[model samples]
Each structure stands twice: as C-alpha cells, then as structure tokens.
Target: MSDQIKFIVDSLNKEPFKKNYNLITFDSLGPMQLLQVLNDVLAEIDPKQDVDIREEMPEQTAKRMLNLLGILKYKPPGNATDMSTFRQGLVIGSKPVIYPVLHWLLQKSNELKKRAYLARFLIKLEVPSEFLQDETVADTNKQDISAMEEEKDQLMKRVERLKKRVETVQNHQRMLKIARQLRVEKEREEFLAQQKQEQKNQVSTESLYSGSQK
Candidate 1:
C-alpha cells in the first residue's frame, strides 16, 4: 500500500464529518463543502496512484464516493457498476486495482451534488447577489455602448474637418487659376493696343508726305 492511499484513509478516519457518521453519511452535507473535502482527499490520493486517471472511467470515481457516503447504495461502486449490467461468470482480471484517484473522484462528485442543491435553494430565495450581478452586467454593457458612441462621434468630427480642409484647398486652387487667366488676358490686350497705336502713327506720317509731294 502506497503512503498516499494510507494517508487518504487515515485523513478520512479523522475527519469530523466522517467521524460523525460511522459509515459515510452525506444527507446533511453542503455540496461545496463536500467538494472541498473531496479535493483535499484527492490531493492526498493522486501521488500514490499508478494509472492515468483522465483515461479511466471518470464517472466511476464519483460513484465510489457516493457509495462510500451511503448516498448511492442501489448499485455497487466503481468500474464494477460501469462494466457489467448483469454479472457474467467470466471475469476479465480476477482482481481490479482500486486507486486513490478513483476514490478521490467519487468524493468530489458527492461534494458537487451537495453544492448544486444549496445553489438551487439560494436561487429559490432570490438572493441579493443574483440581482446585484444583473445590475453590474447592465452597467458594464452601458459603459461599453457609451464608449463606442463617443469613438464614433470623434471619427465623424475628424471626417468633417478633413472635408472642410479639402474644400478650402479646392476653392483656393480655383481662385489662383482664375487670377492667372485674367493676368494673361490683360497682358494680351495691352500688347494689341500698343500695336494698333503704332500702325496709326505710320499711316498719319505717310498721308502728310503724299500731300506735300502733290
């Protein structure tokens, strides 16, 4: 026998609850408390076990705990109940290895069942914590919604500013183009006027000379 298994057996022998009941009695126990005890026992049991508990029939551990507590007596505990619906004369391994892990699992299941029962009772009373939780969740959701709206507003403002800036740049460019065109037109007009005045002076000089010749 490994020291770990011996440790579990010894611990349970001394536990206040187990001592209260000669055999295992779970009827008056709270679920959460029972689970804690089960976990404690399992902690002691795992190091001594030879098998990988995760690969084994996990449910059997639960069954064993309940059976040990005298809560589930209708069927025999452990893999025996799991493997055979009706006993066949043929047995696979004449002896099955009972590990501390299996027993620990059983203990945990019993504890969980008790806790579930307590939870149900608390729910029936409509405890304050339940309502408080709903309010907290609602407040959290509201904050998230408000934050999103604020971000959206900021993005919209930024877009509006960018649009205004683009419009101003476009307007300035249009004005500059128009000013250049007007300047070019004024220069062309001045050049044409100068040419016209020069032609008039030459014609006037030619007419005067012709008259003199006559």
Candidate 2:
C-alpha cells in the first residue's frame, strides 16, 4: 500500500476512535500481528463480526478473516490476486498482496461502520424531516425515485414477456399431449372393429360349411 493510504487509515484509527495500531510495520507484519489488526479493524466496523484467532491455527485464522471480509462485500484489489491471497500475504508475509487488502480495509472501516449504522437506523426510524428539508437532497431523492420507477417498469415488462413465452410453450405441450391420447384411443377403436369383422367372417364360413355337409 502507498504511504498516503496508510496515513489515512492510521489517522482514522488514531483520531475519533483512539485505536492503537502498528502502522509503521504494517507492510512487514507477521500472520499473528496481521490477524490482530484484522480483528480490531473488523470490530471497529461491526462488533458482531469479531474473530478469535487465539486458539486456531494460522491458516484457520486467515481463512476465517477472509470469510468476514467477504461478508462485508470486499473484493481483493487486483485482478491477479484473488481472495485466496490471504494465506500467502498474511501468513507468508507477501507485501504486494497483503498490504493492498489491509489498506482497503483500513480505508473502508469508517464508511462501513456508518453504512451499518444507517441501515439499522433506517429500519427503525423514518427519514428525518431535517434531511428532506434541504431542496438539493429532496430533488436528488425525487430523481432517484423516478429512475427506480422506470427500471421497475422495464423489469415488469420483461417478466410479462417471459410469462407469455412460457404460456405459449405450455399450450403447445398441452396440444401434443391431447394428440397422443387421441392417437391411442383411435388405435384401440380400430383394433376392436377389426376383431368384430373377423368374428363375423368365421361365423359365415361355418354356416357355409354346414350347408355343404348337409
């Protein structure tokens, strides 16, 4: 990670939260130190997301840390380095791979915390009139709502079109099923008619033979 980002994260931890971190050796941290930092950062973001690395192995701690980060919707920075980079970077001390993730985590910690708070706040509390009282905020919200309505309409139309196609397919299948039933019924009727004709022919042949014999 760049010095600028490290400073930002360090400053953020220092100021309002008064959280202590080994930012100077952030890039060269061992797996255990890294795990402590991770747990602290996650706790700062959300207390419910705290991880215990005390009894677990290094690999378990690394994997569990990655899982927690994943729950917060954090994707690894580079296209080359995927989520699996945790063990190599955190455990094996790969600077290029690990620092970026830590940098991202540090930078996003406050933002995520605020978002979590807002989500809970909105669930229980209605939108405060003070925020809506601002013309800019109200207008922006109105524009957003209008756009969302348009998107919803488009999605509903697509769903209706799909339903129509499905109905057409169902109708075709129904017709084919009826056709098969009719074919089987017609075959059975033809077989019964043929059997009756053969019985009459045998009876006529017997009568003719009896007359000739007499």
Candidate 3:
C-alpha cells in the first residue's frame, strides 16, 4: 500500500473513539460528541466543507466517514508526489486529511529509519477488503433498483395512453351509430308523410269528378 493510505489507516485507528473502545460497537459517545469528532477529522481534510455531521444515528456517521475515505483513495486532491513535496502542498492549500497524517508518518519514518513502526501501524489498522467490496455491491444494487423502477413507471404511462386511445375509439364508434339511427328515423318520417299526402289528393279528385257529373 502507498504511504498516504497507510497514514489514513493509522489516523483512523488512533481516533479517540477507536482507541478507547471497539469500533464495531460504535456508541462510545453521544450524538453531538460524535458529530464533533467526525467534523474534527473532516476539518483536517477540507475545513470549508465541514458544515454538519450530526445524524439521526451513529451508523450514518460511520458510513459517511467510510465514504469520505473511499473518495480520498479514488480521487485524491492533487497529483501524487514524494512525501516532502506532498507536505509542502498541504501547507499551501487544504488537502485531504490523509496528506497531513502521512506527512507526520513520513517524518517519523525518517527520524527512526526503521520499518517496524510502519509495519505496526499497518497491522493496527487492518481494514478488511470485504468491507470495501460490500460497499461497492450495495451501490450497484441501489442503481439497479432505481433503473427498474424508472422502467416500470414508463410502462405504466404507456398503458395509460393505450387506454385513452381505446376509450376515444369506442366513443367515436358510439357517435357514428347514433348518427346512423337518427338519419334512418328522419327518412322513415318523410316517407310516411308523402304517402298520406298522396292518399288525400286522390280523395279530393274523386269528390270533384262526382260534383261535375251531378
């Protein structure tokens, strides 16, 4: 592992919460106290970004810390450099907490000129690879679930549109049927009136012929 990573692990291990109690049982402090500690660590990384660390639960705070560390590992603030140059960069501008922590470790390493301390610090941190893998899997699953939900919503909208089209077609068919029935009724009434007029004209002609004969 790189010196920066080693330092981050070391600093995390040295945290008061981790030093005083088991990290697995993460309830050594109250909410506000826990928030303060988290912010203090984050301040070493990016002081301006430390707005609020208060969470409804301790697990949330722990998760946030883990995520921050992951980001530092994947996307460091600046280009990789030797321990000396890296230290200078921190003095110039704010960097992740790992930069300062590693600077301290590098100084100690130069003074002692021994690898034993570094080895012990690594052993003390002992972060599990499976934990990082699990985080990755969880994120992937969440994305997949979100995608499936979006697809489902799209299909529902399509079904609604089809339903509206079917209703429109049915309404149009009913209107056409009503119009055909009205046309047939009007033609039948006209035919009956014509027949009655013809019968009246025939009777009037017969009466006029009988009066002329008389």
Candidate 4:
C-alpha cells in the first residue's frame, strides 16, 4: 500500500499539519513518531477529543482512543477485525494494517474538521437566550454564524467534486469483472454517503441559525 502511505505522508506535510516528516517508508516509522502523528491528526479532526498518545503512553489510553475511533465508525480493512490487532499495528507503526487506517483518517480529516466545528456550533445552535440578552454576544454569534455559512458553501462544492469522482469511478468499475474489487469500492461509496450526511447536518444547522436570525 505504498500509494496509501504516499497520500498520508503528502497530506501530513501540507497545510494545517506541515509536518515535514522524513520518512523513507511507513515501516521506518517508530512508535513515538507514529503516536505523535496520530495525536496531531486527532487534534485537527476532533479538537474535543482528549487524546495524547505519548512516548510512554499506557495501554488503557491507547485502547480508549481506539474506542473513540470505533465510535467514529472507523473500520479496519478486514472482516471482523479486533481492537487488539489495530492496537498492535498502530502502536508499532507496522505496515499493511495501520497504513489503510491512516489513509482513511486523512481522507476524512477535512470533513471531520468541519464536523468538529459544527459540534461546537450546535452547542449554541439555538442562539442561546442567555447570550441574546447581551447585544455584543449576540452580534459575535451572528458573525460566527456568517463565517460558518461560508464554510458550508465550500463544503458543498467539495461534496459536488466527490460525487462526480465517485460517479466516474463507479461507472468504470461497473465494467470490471472483479467482484472482490467492486466490494471494496462499495465500502468507499458508503463512506462518501456518511460524509454527505454530516454535511447535510451542518446545512440544516445553518438553516436553523438563519431562521433564528430573523
């Protein structure tokens, strides 16, 4: 899965992360570096998540983070995979298993980042009457809501691109006679659907805020 590793490495080295990690290969990654990378990503995607995979991280802490990943509906690339297996590969930065997981995480990073922001927005989605009593606080919330709407527009454009790409890929795969490969494509289709739902949730949240504004 060199391609997967390349995508993760390229993404991590780019904006928001800019982690210029000198990695010749995934296998060359150490446990400390691996945990550091995981921590950085978790911070970006889910700021509310309290994860800190340190050099001497305990097993309980690692397992709890894995459970959080599970709650996020992360599926390892295998049938009925166990947490222990994921823990081992991830903790050691071993190849094959961890690469796919990391690839999936990076793929969802932008979407999750928005969701994390949406989560915070939802906390005060009602415009909280407490804040409404103060004109300054209400105005500040209005500004934040305006910024969120712009972000939602960008998210919609991205959703359009993903839909087009998925359509092209599905059409090409339909002609392929490989059942196994098609099954893999189906999983990606499901993931795209999940991302779409999250974006829809944000859109609906924005609508509620707009109505409250009026």
Clashes per model (N, Cα, C within 3 A)? 4, 0, 0, 0
Task: Report lDDT per candidate.
Answer: 0.44, 0.60, 0.48, 0.65
lDDT of 2 by residue, 1-214 (tens): 4685566457546755465555565545575655576666667777754666677676655555554454455555654334344444655546565556566767777787876455432322233343344344345445545666677679899999987886778577788789999999999999999999999999999999999999
Residues 68-174, candidate 4: write the lDDT tens digits: 35434566665443545656675565566556767888999877666555554442345424224334434555665677778778989999998788678855566
Better structure of 1 and 3 per lDDT: 3
What's each prediction's TM-score? 0.22, 0.43, 0.24, 0.48
The count of backbone overlaps in candidate 3 is 0
Rank the models by TM-score, top first: 4, 2, 3, 1
lDDT by residue for model 3 (17-63), tens: 24333333333344354445445555445443355554334344444
lDDT of 1 by residue, 13-83 (tens): 66432534222242234433344455344434332222333344434433333322222122323444442
Off by over 4 Å in 3: 1-35, 47-49, 74-131, 136-214
True-vs-predicted CA distance for residue 184, candidate 1, Å: 0.7
| Candidate numbers, best lDDT first, in rank order | 4, 2, 3, 1
Q: Please give the range of 10 consecutive residues that has the lowest summed lDDT in model 4.
A: 123-132
Measured over all alpha carbons after superposition, the RMSD of each candidate to the real structure, in angstroms, is: 32.6, 23.3, 29.0, 25.2
Pairs in clash, predicted candidate 2: none
